[model samples]
Target: METVTTRTVEYPADGLTMVGHLALPAGTGRRPAVLIGPEGTGLNDFQRRRADALAELGYVALAFDLHGGRWFTDPQEMLERCLPLIADPERLRGIGHAALEVLRAQPRTDPGRIAAIGYGTGGAVVLELGRAAADLKAIGTVNALTTGRPGEAANIRCPVWAGVGSEDPIMSAAQRDAFTAELQDAGVDWRLTVYGGARHAFHHPPVDQSVVPGVAHHPRHARRAWHDVLALLAECLPVAAG
Candidate 1:
């Protein structure tokens, strides 16, 4: 097994030096990598654990901080924090590219086989990358692909897999149908897995959702969602564009 190494990196974005962690799998060969987009709140325990899990699978994983600061003052404050960036897909795409560049530049990472996975806003970030960042191989998005990207939609050349809870309040039924339709029009190979009886943020087990509405957690779906992330990465990044 490769020894895991974690280090802090300063990413220039959004008007500040955003902090991120680089989890590298031991040994020097070029390894597949994934840039993890943080949830609406920011980088949290769940994101870090996911990074560690990816490293254990022999991939260089970067858990990036899209939101300002290390932590949030409150969840409602999330509106003020992420609304601007989220509303504008272009900024989100720039953040994704910056993070991708950071990860791809790492000595241990395989730049040619890079992919991205993000939760909440982060999920949207990765999905947009799949559409806008032609260089990205695969995209894993969970419960965060809300808005539509018009021109960017038709350009995503890589495989896309989205995870959504059947009961997720954030994702409307119409939105799902439209998303699928867009993928078809673009000729992008994509899959949508809707977890029955699950809610939003299903992958974050220990999250405290006191402030969040209709966003509950289901362990079964979370487990399956995490497992599928690995399988998707393996399939897409391995044959991804170099």
Candidate 2:
């Protein structure tokens, strides 16, 4: 197995000191980089492990924070903060841009070859970044099917892949339709996968704390979504083989 190094990186985002988990693959040569955005609950071990896994695959990965080092165990509290943030495109773009800058600054990262993969609110942030015309090779989101402002998706310069549970009330069929319609109308290269019978946050593991309604873990679909993300990255921002 390749040796992966991990560290905590603190950066400013949304007026908070966002502490992100940065993972670097072995060797000194620059590699394709990926930004991992955490769910609305905030950055935690799950996302850190994902960054390490990506590093093991030879891509520099940074699991960026949303709650500035705090994890919300209360679903209502999480919604109180995240709902407004997700609704504001500019705020989401600011957070994504800050994390992207942090990732690009790393010596191991090939700035020109970078992708963003986000979960839930994090997914929404990366989508907003794409809408804002940030230079990204690919954008992948799970459980977040947010539509951008009028015609702003035309600014997206790369392919986008989205995964969501069919039973997810938050990202319902109608919402998915609107999101896809926006992307299609903008002529962006995009794809959406609906996992049958899964609920919102199916990609997330079960938490000890109380979770929002309609959120559940589907291990099978979670694994499938991860594989889909890997495939998308392989196709769009492949790291050079050693």
Candidate 3:
């Protein structure tokens, strides 16, 4: 069977019934899977498509919802709800670990071999997993990461990748430079790929946001980011024989 199935998974955490979509490859035998963190907007279509794509590749994929299905395009309100999680770095780590746990419950999933991929704000959450020391094989982050917190990149024992655009407004050269320096100082086995001229959320194939005159687009970088993700995932989550 080529089809993957999904359901609203309710987990007990943080005083809410956190809902998520779990996608598993049909007729699989212990496939390696991952916990895919959604972009700034909760469990949006982009993430669901990505999870489905992973299933087509014969891997189980679960896209976790940190926002509990609530979202806003207004930058201010978005900041309001999302700010606190990042504010307390320790709490963010807990949330990351919690999402990983849900990924482990898939029947066809190989708990021993799983990774994480986070986008935008979700990228920061995945980064915190390193601080909390989640037992993950690998981790990938796509743009919008912070480096100010203490022990942000310390003792990360997994193969990690940080992908961002050179022209991204949020992750400026100076900020990303500092983030990379911390990663190196912590002795992490990681790869930092910077796309020449892509904006903050360039990975999404179709975005209808009003361009703010300054940020530019680079489809080449967007494509390369996807390739890099697959390459990293292959390196992180190995396939097994039936």
**What is the C-alpha local distance difference test score of each model?**
0.81, 0.94, 0.76
| Candidate 3 displacement at residue 149 in angstroms | 3.7
Taking all chains together, the TM-score of candidate 3 against the true structure is 0.91
Candidate 2 lDDT at 100 equals: 98
lDDT of 2 by residue, 1-242 (tens): 55899999999999999999999998889999999999999999999999999999999999999988999888888999899998899999999999999999999988888999999999999999999999999999999999988989999999999999999999999999999999999999999999999999999899953446788899999999999999999999878642
What is the C-alpha lDDT profile of model 3 across 1-242, one tens digit per residue? 35787777777555556677788788848888878887765677778888888887878888888776675665567667777877777766766777788888777888888888898777778878875677778889888566746664675779789898877877888988888888888888878898876787788764545633334446778788888988988777766432
lDDT (Cα, tens digit) per residue for candidate 1, span 1-242:
55888887888876767788889887778788989998888887668878888887788999988864466647778768788887888888887887888999999888778888889899887877777754777888898755566766777768888889888877877878888888878787989999898887877765568778778878888889988888898777652332
* Pairs that collide, model 2: none
Q: Which ranges of candidate 1 are over 4 A from the true structure?
A: 238-242
In candidate 3, the residue pairs with backbone N, CA or C atoms under 3 Å apart (3 or more residues apart, or in different chains) clash, namely: none
Clashes of 2: 0
**Candidate 1 has what TM-score?**
0.93
What's each prediction's TM-score?
0.93, 0.97, 0.91
Sort order, lDDT high to low: 2, 1, 3
Q: Rate residue 37 of model 3 by lDDT.
A: 81
Q: Rank the candidates by TM-score, best first.
A: 2, 1, 3
lDDT (Cα) of model 3: 0.76
